[model samples]
Target: MYQTKTKREKIKLFLIILIPILITQVSMYGMTLFDTIMSGRAGAADLAGVAIGSSIWVPVSMGIVGILMALSPIVAQMVGAKQDQDVPYTVQQGIWLSITIGVIVSILGFIFIDPILSFMDLEPRVQHVAKYYLISIGTGIIPMFVYNLIRCYIDALGQTRISMFIILLSLPLNIVFNYVFIFGKLGLPAFGGIGAGIASSLTYWIALGLSVWIVHVVRPFRKHHIFRSWSKPSFKSWISLLKIGVPIGFSIFFEVSIFSAVTLFMSVYSTYTIAAHQAAINFASLLYMIPLSIAMTLTIVIGFEIGAKRISDAKHYAYMGILSGMFISIFAGAILYIFDDPVARLYATNPEVIELTKHFLFYAIFFQFADGIGAPIQGVLRGYKDVNITFWMSLVSYWIIGLPSGWLLANYTNMEAYGYWLGLIIGLAAGAIALFTRMYYLQHSLQKKLDTQQS
Candidate 1:
């Protein structure tokens, strides 16, 4: 029953999915750059403090988002199967689940901010600044998670344009707020790092509110009572989502933890080294959003196809998505390679930091290509609901190989800062290879199953 889409149709679908992802990621990257520029203007201490605070915040937040991603594939499948009525209930269940998890994370994050900063052994000034940053930003966790819930639902329904529009609208506001709070501009008190945190918190909620209003009250999707109905939580639906989501969350956590751990380890180096590391890492993060967006979109698409029982078409779309991602990433990596110096200079004025960051930029370039190759592959596997294998593969790649190798290289070898980045490259390479292997086998098996059933 697989509908073999024409080349024109496939290309149109790919572009439709790709463009919004590109726009959304570019907007987010711009916002990150704006935040860095604002913090850098404040002082090196402020920049470093915000960087550390974000290192802690990003992993946990992404893990929560990952859990919510479980909803996307389910919704996509439902839509593909043309079970339109059930879509709203599934979306509602996802929102409730994300809210519950967000509350727990926010409470724990607020309670442990100080102790965790102490554990990181930050310099006194950095510690003081980070404490303020954490408290202010931690308060926004609920809204942040809530936003993701809405985002996942929209994305599942193939309505990513709204998310892109929201990011574009919110970004300038975030910049303006950061400028006002970080520098005492427009007769506002300079809240320094705390102000930056406050700006992020406020804008996050504003974006969430706007997204909700658009999806629930706007022209097209407004008729759905899923947004208006405050139905009692369904234990069965929650458990189903959780069963699919937790492994996915832990898998994301495992990957992000490697990066977080590297940032923490880099803190032991000189301030110059740390700043350089942050600059390189920041650029890498921006580059990563490209393939990440593609991966997510591909997951939604493949989920829909599979749910329609078009296994062969699902596999084809998955391959096409991964190929497109790889080619784009290769081009992006080349651009990074060529523009590394100018990019680093955009972030920091210090000569030594810029020079050091240039060295690490090479590593970032390599990793970007690897990520482009790997991310969509993993995403396709997720579309197939082959998540448990994906989990084990990530654990083996990151923990078994990445962490120990990084520790040995950074501390035992003479590599130091370079070792930290090298470890990342190695981990990503391992992950890419493993994911590709898994996708190949899974795709083959899926096709064989389809063939047998057809025969």
Candidate 2:
């Protein structure tokens, strides 16, 4: 039977899931933040190289991550419907899929790394660093995917705190690795920008090890007997996962690629501009973890409620999640506005880089507002498994409307790099409206169906 949670109970539960996921998300992003900071300390060439390399790597890898993200809602609904026996099989299949995609993407990265960097027409120093950075990071892609796949499973089982702890433990080690590799500490050769990738790769492997240990030793996860039962590779299961995962993967790719595209566009300017763009966007992403975590929690909460046939509870959580996201964005926006200079100073010592970064942060304020609304709605939509429309909407908003408009303004008008930020604002606002309308439609449709069944 579906358990009906009270509004206060729902909010409490929401925070329980949201907080650990927030910390986990933040800790993961922290790895990238440190990479950028450490690389910057190495030099502008190193910083820009890592930034460009990251621009290429993040969108591609995250698209794959998005594909794996489907496991969360898939597992949540099964848990809600009391299908515990099937959870292990579902996760095992996800593991199979993760390894497959990871290998394919890793191979593609190595093959295309040279061509992609060559096409960018970057300075020789920057190009060399970017190439090696991607190669180093690419080595750990399989472990990273497997780790995230397991993370989705664990989080779906309401053990987000465990996932949070795993990442927290890894964060300090990632810093140590970065310090040792980037600066030749502890008898290691200095690799500069490449060290960031080496550090990240090592971190991924360690996190994967810890995740495996947790699933084996942790009481709650051990009960699932995920390892005790072995399931053969099933094409049926792969199709089931891909049905939900593929669109999600593409949707994230579309949204993230726009930013990557912008970074590529920025490369035509100066090394200082690319470094500044990376810094501003990096911090903005850190702040974005709030709404994103809320959204992810909604996916779990609402998916479970929906699976249990508790429509009202799902709607309630969605409303609460969206409102909470918007409220937090307001506070984050103020912080960005007030602390832009200080924030920019954190990323670069070069005066020109700092000044350019401050300008980008100003534009990020508007970007955050739209994302606050849109991101949680996305979580709500994912909870409903209404992903196909999202993929199309994201394609239109980010690629069709956002990128084209930004490209024109940057090329034809005086806005230059700022044009892309305005374009991002416009795109996100449009996406928010589209997604919000879709969420309301689904809620109403579900209510109508429920009322009819009652009558």
Superposed model 2: Cα runs more than 4 Å off: 1-4
Put down candidate 2 lDDT per residue, 1-455, tens digits, no spaces.
13545878887888889999999999999999999999999999999999999999999988999999999999999999999888999999999999999989988877887788888869999998999999999988999999999999998877899999999999999999999999889888999999999999999999999999999888889988888768988989999999999988898898888888999988998999999999999999999888888888988988898889888889999999999999999999999999999999998999999999999999999999998999899999888898999999999999898888888889899999899888888888888899999999999999999999999
Taking all chains together, each candidate's TM-score versus the true structure is 0.96, 0.99
Candidate 1 per-residue lDDT, tens place, 346-436, comes to 7678888789889989888887888898888878877887788888888888888887788889898988778877777788889889999
Error of 2 at 358 (Å): 0.4
- The reply for model 1, stretches above 4 Å from the true place, is 1-4
Best-fitting candidate, scored by TM-score? 2
The CA lDDT of each predicted structure is: 0.81, 0.91
The C-alpha RMSD in Å for every predicted model, in order, reads 1.8, 1.1
Score candidate 2 by lDDT. 0.91
lDDT of 2 at 450: 99
